[model samples]
Target: MDNETTTTYRKIIHIDMDAFYASVEQRDNPELRGKPLVVGGPPEGRGGVVATASYEARKFGIRSAMPSKKALQLCPHALFVRPRFAVYKEVSQKIREIFSRYTDLIEPLSLDEAYLDVTDDKLNVGSAIEIAKQIKQAIKDELQLTASAGVSVNKFVAKIASDINKPDGLKFIGPSAIEAFMEQLPVEKFHGVGKVTADKMKKMGLHTGADLKKLTQDELTGRFGKVGKFYYQIVRGVDERAVQPHRETKSMGAEDTFAYDLTTVEEMNDELDKIAQAVYNRLLKYNLKGRTITLKIKYHDFRQITRNQSFPFPVGDLETIGNTAKQLLLASGIDDKRIRLLGISLSNFGEAAVKVKGDEVSEQLKLF
Candidate 1:
């Protein structure tokens, strides 16, 4: 299609809350205001991983998925609270209602973020940027919260633009500006370019989109396979993927890479208990249960194995997740092994809703 025809066909907006879980906690509890706050599990003893770190905590080098033990070391005075996914889900639904005022094509990425297509808005508003401003204001006025919005003609540019400014920021990358915006963006900042891929690109003198654009699709695919093909199109601002509102959540899981390895079974079980609790909370939040419980173990040498047991009936309770994982660990024989990571997940949503099936292992991505 022609460029003008393409521009009018899609106009996507990505709305991301500022440290969502932590922000909600701070908003509800005034005592947490202006202090470093982490919402996940307790930060004491064997501890847990951070689900979300407040901007204040982030200043101290604390981040989501980091060990709660390490978060305490970075900011000992930081406040730690277990996540209340139920409350966060409530807030998510409220924000979504606000989004419905502008568009029905809304795809939620998490409880904290969503992608909205406002190309043909319900309100008949022609300006995507204005619609974004209105949505952000509605969130602030109605929910007493702030969010960042990125407006562009497609999902990729809009997702990246939303992060340009954060914690109450809005950026619009129009059709003309997309080229310059992508060219200067750091390779690491590209959505799918993980650290491993970025390191390889840097070693090959490709640090920015401009540097990446020098390679042909065949050359890129030769270097990075499937992901390389993605890079070739993304660098040219050619992401045509539609805003899929009903993206299936194939699996729900929580994993942590620790500061130290567990040399004994006791230590490993403690970590597993924390991870199971996290997984259980997420299950409740999504209102999902699965028949499969997978226990993931990574050793100090980076070797990993997953052992999952399926049940006739789906389970999402805390006890089942924790106890089953511990049992699997025991059967696997963990004697004298140095364990560096532990995670638990529920998969095979098993008729929860909408028939979504998928599995994913996520890497830490920076939020603006």
Candidate 2:
């Protein structure tokens, strides 16, 4: 309510490239820009999955991580292209260079997504949203690709707002609108809530942002343990975390919440299909493979659970991935309770991306 309470919040910007790899393909090849282009593996390439697809490809339901074979089924005519990680990394560097010109407090989640803390920058940018626009313009002009930006008082809302509109879009969540903004958000879409937590919340009759705001911190933390604290703050738009540059990215993964909870093993298997697709899509983008696969579940009473399995060989195939995750989920006998959300994460990383190493490694490579 007071100015001190308000000023304590920092200005954060989340920047995400629009169909990153696909946009790069469109940028280099004049013919691919407007046409439906799939920048991934060969359609007939065995074990291949889509990394990124242009907006045109999306019309055919040729989405990222859909097997190249399945994507062909959806859009046989869609153009299929292999990932050019070298070129993309170059573009990523160029964009990051542009960001450094504004502020050094930039935390890159991946090559495509980053969080910038510009609350007390030397650049003297007037408004957070304005700074986002300028950065987007710079990326467009210099890199020849589009990016979507979100600006807010802190990281949680800014990340969500960035995705509200995609591919050359900008969204702002001013401090005045934070409460209303959070109240309307779906519980499943909360940044750290993930699929498991969302399912639990739903079974507890919590669905929307308004529902979450009503729950006490003790109740949430009692149910979710440490993550409960995150839920408690985000529902009230009270993220206090700073934008940490040089943040260590130990791994990359993805998860999704279901519209309906699962009661039967059959139903859970169906959910794994979707989770596998999501994880595979992220794997392709990060060009990463992992030895460990984790299955996350949320029960009927807001109870969160996780089960994981490790492999001697790296996992890059979809069927093996889905089956592995399903086995872990059922192995835990977690099916007795009704489930609301299912998620999969491939972690325990062994190395940097095969195509793109960390900035430090790249610097070393340059020296050699």
Candidate 3:
């Protein structure tokens, strides 16, 4: 093919490892291979929610982040293991090293997921699908782990296609095949559209991707605000968002719904402390020193609200975390109400060492 003709097609790949942490444990200990293994905390106490589960556990409707008691109720024979972040991170680095051989345009969504743009690769790969197959096989053979990959002309299609088939699955979507591929795609599957958006779309008579396309841009924009433009383009299978690396940091946080609404200051404080630790851990890992601390609270009636305060200096200390959270709690002045959820987030991150997107403007936007 002519060079100009070749330049018309962009090659993008999204690779996600299959049940990463749980799979790693199973791979290292063959005895755990066929069992329904869950990785997280113990299956007894309040903090025991599964972080990852083997595919066998999934068949029993046991899923990640589900309560350990609930998972055991679903799969009584399931095996539970503690989370090993160090091991998973090591495997992730190894996987990224493998991708560097094909393209340096890599944007990691998480330790187990990433987007790769190979349009200007030095490897001179002729076929995107062939490259995806090779990457998957390499992961399996070298790491003794399974991975699913999607190859497409852009990031959006590649991400969605990657999940079409799971655990050693590979799918491709070319420019000519975009229309057929999107015809039956659910609104819930659209990029950036979550369960809340899906419900809103359903109420607006939009069910499938085709149905979403019928709405005027203004209509979708009115419904979705700023992200409507993305929805419109996705419905038409036209996402211009490049898979460039080094996108900046915008916001980070953690939230949790309680099994029962908490009515006391002590109970709320306990939950807030846990959330703060989670936020701080992530901040330390990413080397993010944030100046703002936010607290989110939800009442028994589902009336949710948030409060935030900016500090003079970037903070990552537990004392600052607790105090900022307490200040927010006092500011909300909802002590009489039964709190159903608590969340803590550190934002206003300063300069970071890594970039996730190539465009400086996009990096400033801090979009994922």
Candidate 4:
């Protein structure tokens, strides 16, 4: 490579808090510590699910987004509590503050995970590993929480490295070592490979990065569609995306997986109404309004469909959410299909989050 065209490797870090919401609840309430605790809606409530669970609860297979009723069946003595978004957001802010002390290139994937570009450390820390160590220490000392950090030359490798060691684990993959690292990774562990895709890849005799490398880019693309191009490069330890700071939330919405299937329009409508209200409330909280509304329905047999409509202007009202979702569901012609899940979301954010009403809501209530 010419001098001007040589690759300039960047030091990137991905940090993920360990069971964040459940940890916060455990920290604030001493009585909940060292026990199987779940943070989310009560199991008896309609559409209840586990938002997150402590490591203790996870021992019994409790997990984030799992149905709380199933979680109860898995661990009968598990304590389930409603989520306190305000508290969790506060902790998230504190975590971001700590990151800012090291680098401004911070992209939050959620309240619990973030990616930081520390190619030039603000603290003048010579090593990215040291910077990660300081960040993990700060969270432990200040917030009484643990975070896993993954460090590497690029975002893709760094993200995978971070999960290698969980619940306060740190791993680093250097540029020279990344290729060997990628070759050993399972197909399911790649960024875009879900369970279904992994199964398909297995059937194709591609179970590892090495197996995938045997296929040419054209062949992979032919088999996996557009994402195959990504796999072709990533299996070679190449990902050129930067760590963007202002990664905006493209869409915001609420969804629910019902405890029982709904076969009637009345039951489905009632459920959609609740979901619309939840979506509307979130829009207000985020100070976001969108021109498009999307409805998602999952049938009892696991078939799913999504329908969307765009208005000429932005909408952030309860009526619009409920009516638009109901219309879409009806238009979908569910007929006698039993629905197991329903969701409503707003998108096409051409505006910023703002105060929708004249009354001043507390800053503590602000969530995005």
Candidate closest to the true structure, highest lDDT: 4
For all predicted structures, in order, the TM-scores are 0.78, 0.67, 0.78, 0.81
TM-score of model 3 relative to the true fold?
0.78
- Residue runs of model 3 more than 4 Å from their true location after superposition: 1-7, 252-287, 295-307, 316-344, 350-368
lDDT, model 2, position 235 = 81
Give the local distance difference test score of model 1: 0.84
Candidate 1 lDDT, 127-202, residue by residue in tens:
8999999999999999999999999988999999999899899998888888888899999999988899899999
lDDT for 149 (candidate 2): 96
For all candidates, the clash counts are 1, 0, 7, 1
Candidate order by decreasing lDDT? 4, 1, 3, 2
Task: List the pairs of residues colliding in candidate 4.
Answer: 287-353
Error of 4 at 32 (Å): 2.2
lDDT of each: 0.84, 0.78, 0.80, 0.85
Task: Please give, for residues 163-212, the per-residue lDDT of candidate 3 as tens digits.
Answer: 99998899988898897778689888876778998998899898998887
RMSD of candidate 1 to the truth, in angstroms, is 5.3
**Candidate 4 residue spans exceeding 4 A from truth:** 1-7, 41-47, 256-287, 296-308, 317-342, 350-368
* Backbone clash total, candidate 2: 0
Name the top TM-score candidate: 4
User: Tens digits of per-residue lDDT for model 2 on 1-368?
Assistant: 65554356688999999999888888889988788888765755233567878998898888776767788888878888877766777888888898888888888777788899888765897678888999999998887889999999989999999999986999998998998989999998888777887898899999998987788889888887877778888888888888777544355554544434568888888868976876776676667787888887777575888888888877867887899988888788863678766777776767644533324221100100
